[model samples]
Structure formats: structure tokens, C-alpha cells
Target: MNSIISEGVQVSVETFYQPDYSNPVQSEFMFAYRITLENHNAFPVKLHRRNWQIFDSNGSHREVEGEGVVGVQPTIQPGESYQYVSGCNLRTEMGKMKGTYQMENLNNKQMFTVDIPSFEMIVPMKNN
Candidate 1:
């Protein structure tokens, strides 16, 4: 797991390779990642959008931008957290992902960007 704190918000990530969904013979690899967002500010924050940068060992890259995470904008209160699991498909067995979340402070309507720590996705066997 990897974690980072940005603008009073903490983002943690854990990644796993899904062998069942991957077809190495065809150069397709699937990975699932769990992200935990923690609000440390005194006010509540609502996630508005998400932007991700994905990289594969084969020199392939993808950028994904969308409204909210997993299809919903979640409000997280101080000392509270929101967690979700999402998947990514890559052309290689090794890859990485990093991104940011656009959040708004419900109390003051202040918008800020929260960094989602970069994490690696590698087949378990590759760790050796």
C-alpha cells in the first residue's frame, strides 16, 4: 500500500493483479486497485471529478478523466473516509497509476485538488 496527503486529504492505494481476468498470451493484464480517501479538514468535502494517468511497461499510456469515482460523488466528513475498488487493463504485466481528485469543501465551497499516490501493478510472480 502507498499513501500521500495533500491539502489536508489523505489518499491511500493498494493494488492487486487479477490473473483470472488477464490473458497473458494476448498481452492483456488486468489489475484492481483499492483507494481510501480520508478527510482531515474540519469541514466536509465532496469529490467532484477524477483524473488518472496509467502507464504500462510496454510504453503504453492512457489518460482517464471522469465525473466522480465509480460513478458517484461522495461526501466525506472530517475524520471520515471513503473507499472504492476499481480496475485497470494494461497491455503488459507491469504498470502503474497515479491521479488526482477534484474536491470541494462543503462549508466554504472551496475547491482543491487531492493527490492520489502512485502505485504499481505487477503480477505476483514478477515480484521474484
Candidate 2:
């Protein structure tokens, strides 16, 4: 259970590798992930953008920045939890990613970051 606190919001992740759909010998891996964002603050907030630093097993690192995950910026109230499932592709069979969500506190004119905990992605060998 990897969780990080960003602007009072706790974000955690669980990754599932799709080895049946990957070609590890060719350095192609597929993984699906579920991220949970819990607003443990007393105020409400909305996720605006994504900023991440991803490091692959091959010593390659990439920075991905984007707005509105899955094309929607949903507002989550206080004590609420938001979850989304997404997928990503990597050139290696394993890697680690950590990032923060740019969030806006609707209650006040303040913007804060919600930390995303470092999570691992691994494509387990498919059993015959």
C-alpha cells in the first residue's frame, strides 16, 4: 500500500500487469493501474493536472504532464474518495512512478499539490 499526501489529499495506487498482452522479450510491457484519491481535508478540492516522474528499469526517465485525467476534472468534496482506472505502456518489464496532482481548493483561493506515492509496475511471467 503506497500512499502520498498532497495538499491534504492522499493518493494511493495498485498496479496490475498484463503479461499475456506483453512481449517482455521485446521490451514491451502493459499494465493497468487503479488510483485512489482521498480528500481527508475539511475543504473540497478538484484535481487539475498531472505531473509525474517515471523511471524505467532501463535507466530511462520521463516526465509526463497533462491536464484533466481521462478528460474530466471531477470535484471531490471533503471526506470523499475518488478513484480511476488507467493503463500505461513501458519499454521495460518494470519501473517506478511517483508524482503529484495539481489541485485547487474551491473553498479558498489556494492551490496545493497532492503527492502520489511511488508505485511499481511489473509484468509477471505468464504461467503455462
Candidate 3:
């Protein structure tokens, strides 16, 4: 797992290779990642948006920007955490992902960015 803290928010990520969902012969690889967002601030925070930079070992790169995550925006209270699982597909056996979350402080309505540490996804057999 990889974690990073910024603006009093902590982001942790764990990734899993999905063999059942991938077709290596066709150059399609699937990976699922679980993200946990922890609020270390004294007040609650709401996640508003997400931006991701995805890179593939085959030299493919893409950027994804969207509202919320996995569908709904969640508000995490102080000392609380919110978690979600999401999937990504790559044209290669290995890839990496990193992003940022836009969050709002519930107490002051101030917006801030929380960094999501870069995480790698590799096929189990490719680890060698």
C-alpha cells in the first residue's frame, strides 16, 4: 500500500491485479484499487472531484477528471475515513496511477487538494 498526506487529509491505496477480468492475449489488463481517505483535521471534509494521471508500460498515457468517486461524493468526519474500490484497464502488463482529490472543509467551506500517492499495478507473473 502507498499513502500520502496533504492539507490534513490522508490518502492510502492498495492495488490488485484482476486476472479474471483481463485478456492478456489481447493486450488488455485489468486492475482494481481500493482507496481510503482519512480526515485528520478537526472538521469534516467533503470530496468534490478527482483527477488522475494513468501511465502504461507500453507508453500509453491518459488523464481522467471527474466529479466525485465511484459515483457519489462522500463527507468524512474528523478522525473518520471513507473508502472505495475502483478499476482501471491498461494495454500493458504494468502501469502506474496517481491523482488528487478536491475537497471542501465543512466548517469553513474552503477547498483544498489532497494528493494520492502513485501506485503501481503489475501482473502477478510479471513481478519476476
Candidate 4:
């Protein structure tokens, strides 16, 4: 797992390789990632958007930008947290992801960007 804190918000990530969903022969590799977002601020905040940069060992790159995560905009109170799981597909067994979340402070409606720490995804066998 990897974690990063920005402006009182903490983002942690855990990755897993989905062998069953991948076909190496076809150059398809699947990976799942779980994210935990924690707010340590004095006010509540809502996650409004997300942006990601995905890189594969084969030199493929992907940029993903969307509203909210997993289809819902969640409001997290001070000292509270939210978690979600998402997946990605890569053309190689090794890859990495990193990004940011756009959040709005409910107290003053001010927006801020929280860093999502970079994490790598590699097949277990590849680690050998």
C-alpha cells in the first residue's frame, strides 16, 4: 500500500493483479486498486472530480478524467473517511498509476487538489 497526505487529506492505495481477468497470450493484463480517502481537516469536504495518469511498462500511457469516483460524489466529514475499489487494464504485466482528486471545502466552498500516491502493479510471478 502507498499513501500521501495533502492539505489535511490522506489518500492510500493498495493494488492487486487479477490473473483470472487477464490473458497474457493476448497481451491483456488486469489490475484492481483500492483507495481510502481520509479527511483530517476541521470541515467537511466533497470530492468533485478525479484525474489519473496510467503508465504501462510497454510505454503505453492513458489519461483518465471524470466527475467523482466510482460514480458518486461523496462528502466526508472531518476525521472521517471513504473507500472505493476500481480496476485498470494494461498491455503489460508491469505498470503504475498516480493522480489527484479535486475536493471542495464545505465551509468556504474552496477547492483543493489532493495527491494520490503513485503505486505499481506487477504480477506475482514477475516479482521473482
**TM-scores of the candidates in the order shown:** 0.98, 0.91, 0.99, 0.98
Worst 10 contiguous positions by lDDT, candidate 3: 106-115
Candidate 1 lDDT, tens digit per residue, 73-92?
99999999999999999998
Among all windows of 10 consecutive residues in model 4, the one with the lowest summed lDDT is: 119-128
Against the reference, the lDDT scores of all candidates come to 0.95, 0.85, 0.96, 0.96
Per residue, candidate 3 scores C-alpha lDDT tens digits across 20-71 of 9999999999999999999999999999999999999978899999999999
Candidate 1 clashing pairs? none
Clashing pairs in 2: 6-114, 6-115
lDDT of 1 at 124: 92
Backbone N/Cα/C clashes per model: 0, 2, 0, 0
- Model 1 scores a TM of 0.98
* lDDT digits (tens) for residues 1-128 of candidate 4: 89999989999999999999999999999999999999999999999999999999989899999999999999999999999999999999899999999999999999999999999999889998
Off by over 4 Å in 2: 126-128
Candidate 2 lDDT, 89-116, residue by residue in tens: 8898788888888899999958887788
Two-way lDDT contest, 2 vs 3, winner: 3
Model 2 misses residue 87 by how many Å? 1.5
List clashing residue pairs in candidate 3.
Answer: none
